[model samples]
Target: MGVTGIGGFFFRARDPEALRAWYAEHLGVGSVPYGMWETQAGPCVFSPFPATSDYFAADRPWMLNLRVDDLDDLCARLEEAGIAATRDPEWDMPGVGRFARIHDPEGNPIELWQPEQPA
Candidate 1:
């Protein structure tokens, strides 16, 4: 067979431990302390945006997009925790899905996606 799915996504963080904790606490990413996160099987987008694209901030090299379920609920929870999330009706695509934008403590852009469910 061809290559399997992605094993992990590693990125640089100013404070690795704190950033890891923040992700785990807010997004339920790690679940437990410094633990492995299990992700649901779903479509993953691999398209690369143009360098001059305004899809995300210009200063950052990469933006991390996480596929999630229940976009509204997630946004609410983040708001309760003092995290800001921006949602726009225009961002929704008929077959693609809904999208929201947020940032981590260090100002890294994070896009949360809720894929369209099959009818």
Candidate 2:
């Protein structure tokens, strides 16, 4: 048997409605208030972190990594929306791809990743 990918990533937000709208406008995510994103992708990554893990660097135990096709384009869009985009060089990999960190209006850290293709 094989494990399936992520079903949904749930996190708290001060205002779910505004956050949903932000994602809809900036990232093109059809998000709903207090609801799972209805997407067509499958076999997503559902990872559990250790209590002492510093990977996410958040007060909370988990982080959401949304895969993207074009990191540069998305970052530009986020900037155009007046959302500050933060980049951590240490989080980037040469072949794996680039990662940009950003927090939502509610202060949820979201990692946007664009993975490299296999050679």
Candidate 3:
């Protein structure tokens, strides 16, 4: 049988507890380590970028792209929390989605995407 969806995304955090708290408070992600997070059914993209790809930081090996329901509201909340969520109009596509970029406290790149609604 073919592989199912992504089961987990594990990464090393200098301060795992603090990072977990930050994600829980800001992004509503599960705070418990190794806990299951129920996600809505939607499209997920798994693409490997070139080693020299400038789309994300060169320092980091991987970037996390999360599907979001409301990009504007989430960006506003992030802004209020003093986290800079930068957006460029050029990143929006007719059928793909709108995107914004933000970094975690430890400098990991995260991309927030709001997919275009189906016609």
Candidate 4:
């Protein structure tokens, strides 16, 4: 029983309050006062990208990938709220999942994944 799951994710924010609000309002993350994000129990990817990986911005050290259930609905909601999200056919893995990319107000890349149905 050494480590359980991810307890928290701390990062530097230029305007912490504003960023927090943006995340809560748009992505429904960290909405609680304790900074505890309620997430579904599913696969959590912990791959560290190479320094030159083009998946996200070079200046950014990390990208946040969250597993979602209804990706198309979520993307539509974001777009209705005036947030731009990009979906590409190339990002879909036959047996893995479909992915969509979006950037927060501060330009942090966020990847939303909808996994394939279990056969």
What C-alpha lDDT do the candidate models reach, one value each? Answer: 0.90, 0.76, 0.91, 0.87
Better of 2 and 4 by lDDT: 4
**Count of backbone collisions within predicted model 3:** 0
lDDT of 1 at 57: 93
* lDDT of candidate 1 over 2-42, digit per residue (tens): 96787787899898888889999999887445648888988
Ranking by TM-score: 3, 1, 4, 2
Model 2: residue 97 alpha-carbon error in angstroms: 1.8
How well does model 4 score by local distance difference test?
0.87
* Cα error of candidate 2 at position 6, Å: 2.9
| lDDT score at residue 76, model 2, on the 0-100 scale | 87
Per-residue lDDT, model 2, residue 39, is: 69
Q: How many residue pairs clash per model?
A: 0, 3, 0, 0
Candidate 1 ranges beyond 4 A from true positions: 31-35
- Best-to-worst order by lDDT is 3, 1, 4, 2
Q: How accurate locally is residue 69 in candidate 2, as Cα lDDT from 0 to 100?
A: 84
Q: Considering TM-score, which of the candidate structures 1 and 3 is the better prediction for this target?
A: 3
- Candidate 3 segments exceeding 4 Å error: 33-35
lDDT of 3 by residue, 43-108 (tens): 999999999999998989999999999999999999999999999999999899999999989999
Give the alpha carbon lDDT tens digit for every residue of 46-119 in model 4: 79988989988899999998788899999999999999999999999998999999998889889999999989
Best by TM-score: 3
What local lDDT does model 2 show for residue 27? 76
